[model samples]
Target: MSLPFKTLIKIERGNHLPMYVQIANELIKLIRGGKLTPGAFLPGTREMADLLAIHRKTIINAYEDLSVQGWIESLPRKGYRVVSDLPVIKPRSFQPKNNYPATSISPEELLHLPAFTRPGMVNDYQPGALIVDDGFPDINLTPYDFFLQQYRQQLNSGILYTLNFQKEEGGLLSLRTATSSFLNQTRGLNITHEQVAITRGAQMAIYLAAALLIKPGDRIIVSEPSYFMANQIFQQLGAVIHRVPVDEEGMDTNALEELLKTGTFKLIYVIPHHHHPTTVTMSTARRIQLLTLIKEYQLWAIEDDYDYDFHYRNSPILPLASADHDGRILYIGSYTKLLGPSFRIGYLVAGVQIIEQAIRYRRLMDIRGDFMMESALAALIDNGELSRHINRSKKIYAARLDKTTELLTSSNIPVSFHKPQGGMALWLRFDPQYPLANLLTNASANNLHLYGTAYFEGYNTNYNSLRFGFASLQEQQMEQAVSILAASLKKK
Candidate 1:
């Protein structure tokens, strides 16, 4: 039974396979080659670990694998012995030893793609860095444990039979129903589950709406200095985008009306509440005017209500989708921030016919969404747990927003910003005297992860502004960040 260590095995450290798996694989080869015959006793876990200079757990895992595969059996007091019987598994075709291309592309050819990349792609995560972001919620405040509990209870219950199959292309009926109820109460949209399609997130909902409403060469009106990602999406679809200047009132509905008179547009995309990147809510007058214009032109509108729940000041304005009686608006909202961005749960609200068409397009792109999580969200909504979480987090975020605003104002850095009525971020415009490069370099030197001004610099306009997100920062962090920003501004 004595075997030299070199003769018994050779371990390759550079291999991606875990040491335990490699050990099991080498042992399997020995067993198959009859070097270690059936009923031959093997070394104990401790003996193997010592010989290989690895943790005993590795050897134990290897033994467990061998036992599960019918390769070996453990005796009462003795070590593992090779099994007498084995299952027949046909050998797979031989794979070439040559290095394959990293991508699934031909060696001689190059694949060209549109130069489209995600907006605000983080190049690196610097530890202990304070980030001024484009309005994201504090996911750390999410009720993750409660949601996990519901998921676990459902998984352990008898309803597993129902959830195992594909439910509906529109998504879980329970979630759709729950979303309908929530929207009816909060956003003033009276809808049924049939009028909604659940998507991975609001981005997917935007994609679906665009795919359904827009054709190549179709004109779509959007706000200048609007969401970069939304413009990118429209560009990818070969749609011509017309930008209307946005001021304190939000997307010049007057300009939009003028554009409508001049030419036909397929659809209009608007962020009515806490308008993306700018953090400006559409004035009540503009809302009514925009609604009237859309109705008259029969132009479909995509209203992105991504951060509707985080209103801190006066009550939120009723969504345009709520007042659209002529089927002119498609409302898109996301629970991704409430549950964390990784939980890609969003809903699109439109006429039942439009929803049906969107479902078709959704099926072509993604076969279905996460049913189990959707169902869990439904349970949260039904019991009012989701509402309660929102109510609680809303207050905490409001305080954080106040603290961030206070810090920025006290910094005296010559930065001007409108005191936002609601939402998790402030739209800060620097004085033209301060160079953005100087500000960015100083911010980076102060350990603040400041993204460049690409987000504010849209196709038609370049505003010296940035969305200074507040929800994710604590009071101390906010103070530290503002102090650093002030210091950056003071330098030259």
Candidate 2:
């Protein structure tokens, strides 16, 4: 099945690009055009050179380029063949007829392809600026030395490299085991490592669950002022979002019940422990009622307890999954709040079937999470270092939370907020006279960085509020930040 190479690949010697690149580009066109099918072996470099009347080295260079780009693979004594797993692509009739361009294509031209374009929230805090971040852990508080030591041990033991090549579907087995034990002890979840799938973060876990459960036009319920990023993911997947109001008691389960009666819903996204943007924990009564409704409606629930590790006032409530006997709840959690966001480790706890399917779906986007880091985290959990660090950080953040609350109360800035029992960040509402837009502009001028209230806005409602994160700020920094807020308020 040899093709006419000389006629198919038109060599333009007058073109400025290298001859090898020209040949490589022509072959790529053939492969993409379905002329050269997967597993089809290429002619020997010498044979190809003889056929094309070119230098053998040029053919070698072209093959090398193709191999590096993963278009073709080399087999021992078998020569080069196209990779078997590549998706079949139809030729673009819009492209110039058999005329390949010599110059590199611009990314701007590539952007014309049909794809979702959602920009992520960027953390662009400048150095020397006072910041009220969005409830992120202070990186300075992370036990990096201990974690690095464990990471180095994993590197030296050679387990990381072994696990990298091996297909450990969910994640490293050691980390999953450690995580299972840790959750059972701390959150009362009765599960094994087989029920867990490690993800890059809670965001990825949410995306994976949505991908598995939702279909186009399927109805899903979310809190009115829920995590916006999760809402974007559901919408992107073509799910219709129904918002239920969230008060101090948490997602008004009564309102949710009413909505459930009107239509069929596939899933519900709830943040029971310190609900994002509001910093309110769902009452025990509401949790019970919500769980009962979930069973009644046969709805799948994504219970995101992302910051369950840092409770200050009392012991945190056990996750909804702890009581789920029917495997209706998919629990999502993250280590980003405990170990700084840079760590990027999280997990989804569910039935073995869901875990297995989520792992398969995860492969489509990310092959696997960082094994070395997961192993190191497992060691940290086993050695009690992570628990100790969390205990120590809780006390410091509690004090910071108190100090910030007291200072803001005394400052007379026309602001009101309830001191949260747990989690990082305070939800503060400003007087309507003081627009959040103006306050943000004024704060920016004073070198004080604060997230705008736009993110927390609900459908057809504007709540002039912001989540004032205090965990990342020290006492003196909190004082300075409060002072800046007062000044911003006074600026007309």
Tens digits of per-residue lDDT for model 1, 1-492? 555544577778885446776787788768766788777888888988888898999899989877765678899988898877542222111221111111111111111225643333456767887887666677787778767877787778867677777659899999999999988767766678888899999988988887777777989999887777778778877789998888888889888888899888888999978887778888888887887888788787889985888776766776777774366678899998676667899999887777877887787767889887888899778755576567667768878877777777777778888877778778888876675556776677677866523343445454667678788778888888888888777434
Clash counts for the predictions, in order: 0, 0
Clash list (residue pairs), candidate 1: none
* Residue lDDT tens for model 2, 355-415: 7778887887778888878888997887555765776677688888889889998998898
Q: Give the runs in model 1 whose Cα sits over 4 Å from its true position.
A: 1-123, 451-460, 490-492
Off by over 4 Å in 2: 1-127, 452-457, 490-492
User: Which candidate leads the pack in lDDT?
Assistant: 2
Candidate 1 local Cα displacement, residue 378, angstroms: 0.9
RMSD of each candidate relative to the true structure? 21.1, 22.9
In model 2, state the lDDT of residue 385: 58
